[model samples]
Target: MKKLENLQKQLGYEFKNIKILNEALTHKSTKMPYNNERLEFLGDAVMDLIVGEYLFKKFNKIAEGDMSKLRAALVNEKSFAMMAKELKIGEYINLSLAEENNGGREKISLLSDAYEAIMGAVYLEAGLEKVREIAINLLEICYPKIDLTNLVKDYKTALQEITQADFGVTPVYELTGSSGPDHKKEFEIALLLNGKEISRATGGSKKEAQQTAAKIALEKLKK
Candidate 1:
């Protein structure tokens, strides 16, 4: 239809087999025999490969672990959903009446899956090169808006790396105390670097408090 044609124009790849494109847009909620699930699965792998290769080449000097984190940040559901939203992909999805009423079009999971399915359809119709081109173009548009450095920084992991690299010792997180009622208890945690307390933070849970403390430690160490 007109909508499909417009989407094809937007994607810059006209499908030889429109059925595949239609399948990509069709949600499982429709209960249709042909849906996007299989395409989504294929696309997920394809995306991982493409993104991994991209980061590997672009950040050639970076370590494998750093590249992995960058790839994860780029290919996550939230990032895919943002790309889909930018493309206005939700308007073209074929959802069941119930799903439509429930605002399925705006659902991040649905949008991300559909975007992946569309990528799969593109790959099947065109080729890996063509799909890679499309992905790179989209990523180029998205990259400037993303904080690549922060995206790869897991507080605890960052703290550990810093401590080990600088002091030749690992960072440790200790639960210092807890307050409030049992159900709503808030935990206080401290980060220790080489047996010396570096920072402390409070959060609703021990893990959160530890992360906060780690973040604080990282900040202070960097400063």
Candidate 2:
């Protein structure tokens, strides 16, 4: 009860219909009659438009393709999960005991979905304008210097360019290992240059691991 109040405070927007907020926080694993999936779908669409319009207005002279990439950069599981963490959404989630034991609260997909559902609930209850304000507030906070050049940061490509120039070889990614439940599997990947290991990282998926490893490798190259 009190925790939900704190969640609303964290969001900086109080919900007129608290039940809808609960529905948004309820996971399918709870076997509730009403879960957050539908709200997640709606929120996903809403966020797409919000981000699309933001990019459209922010970069008036940018091409359609570039705008799409920018939107893609922001509207992703990773980005949403980061925002979920910012709002501490995981703490308010209603998960099954099994899921809780499986670290559902920390799962990227779960957090991202909850974030979307919350936004969706907001949109449904208040309207697009209110939800847009909340979304923009979070985006600006999460990415304080949000801009075109830094949005779609392709660390893998940057590392490749650097390695190619110096070692005349591209960085290779090797899947080292994976574990955890199928719904929330963790993948470990090693970044290699000239058949030698440079950096290793673990993430929610292979692509995530690859990107994390690439980012780590890039940092190492920088120093």
Candidate 3:
């Protein structure tokens, strides 16, 4: 109860219907009577609209495709997970003991869904204006630089950029290894820049590992 009160204070918006807030943080894996899936859907739509409007006004010359990609990057699951971590939201979540033990609190998908559910709940408790303020603040805090140039650029994009700009040859990625339990396997990926080993990284998924490798390569090239 005290923890929930502290969380509410940190969010700066007291829920008129606390149940909505509770529902938003509930994960279906816990077999809870209520989950935040519906709220997550609604919040996703709301998030897109807010981000779209912000980009539309700020980057007037930016194309629709570019704006959409940037918005997606800013509001992605990983981004939400970061925000949840910052807020220590996992500690406040109501979860079964087993789920908690399995690191449910730190799960990216679950945290992202909870973030969206909170948005939906806020919109319902207050209004669009309140939710908009919250969304803008959250985004601004998460990305102080707001560099749209690389916001949505993934490992594939980075590799392509490096290949075109430097070697004039495309990079290739190879799966080095995969380890860990089935539910929590870690992938090892290596990216070769024009046939030269550039960087390698490990992640929970192949795409993620590739992205990490590309990111490291980008940093190395920059340095």
Candidate 1 local lDDT, residue 209:
89
TM-score of 1: 0.71
lDDT of 2 by residue, 1-223 (tens): 6579999998878987799999999999999899999999999999999999998998899899889988998999999999999999999999999999999999999999999999999999999999999999999888887665577756888889999999899999999999999998999999989899999999998887998899899899999
RMSD of 3: 13.8
- Model 1 accuracy (lDDT, Cα): 0.88
Q: TM-scores across all candidates?
A: 0.71, 0.71, 0.69
Which candidate, 1 or 3, has the higher TM-score? Answer: 1
Per-residue CA lDDT of model 1 for 43-67, tens digit only, reads 9988998888888787778888778
Worst 10 residues of 3 by lDDT: 146-155
Identify the runs in model 3 with alpha carbons over 4 angstroms from their true place: 153-157, 160-223
Which predicted model would earn the best lDDT? 2
Ranking by lDDT: 2, 1, 3
Model 3 / residue 156 / CA error / Å: 9.2
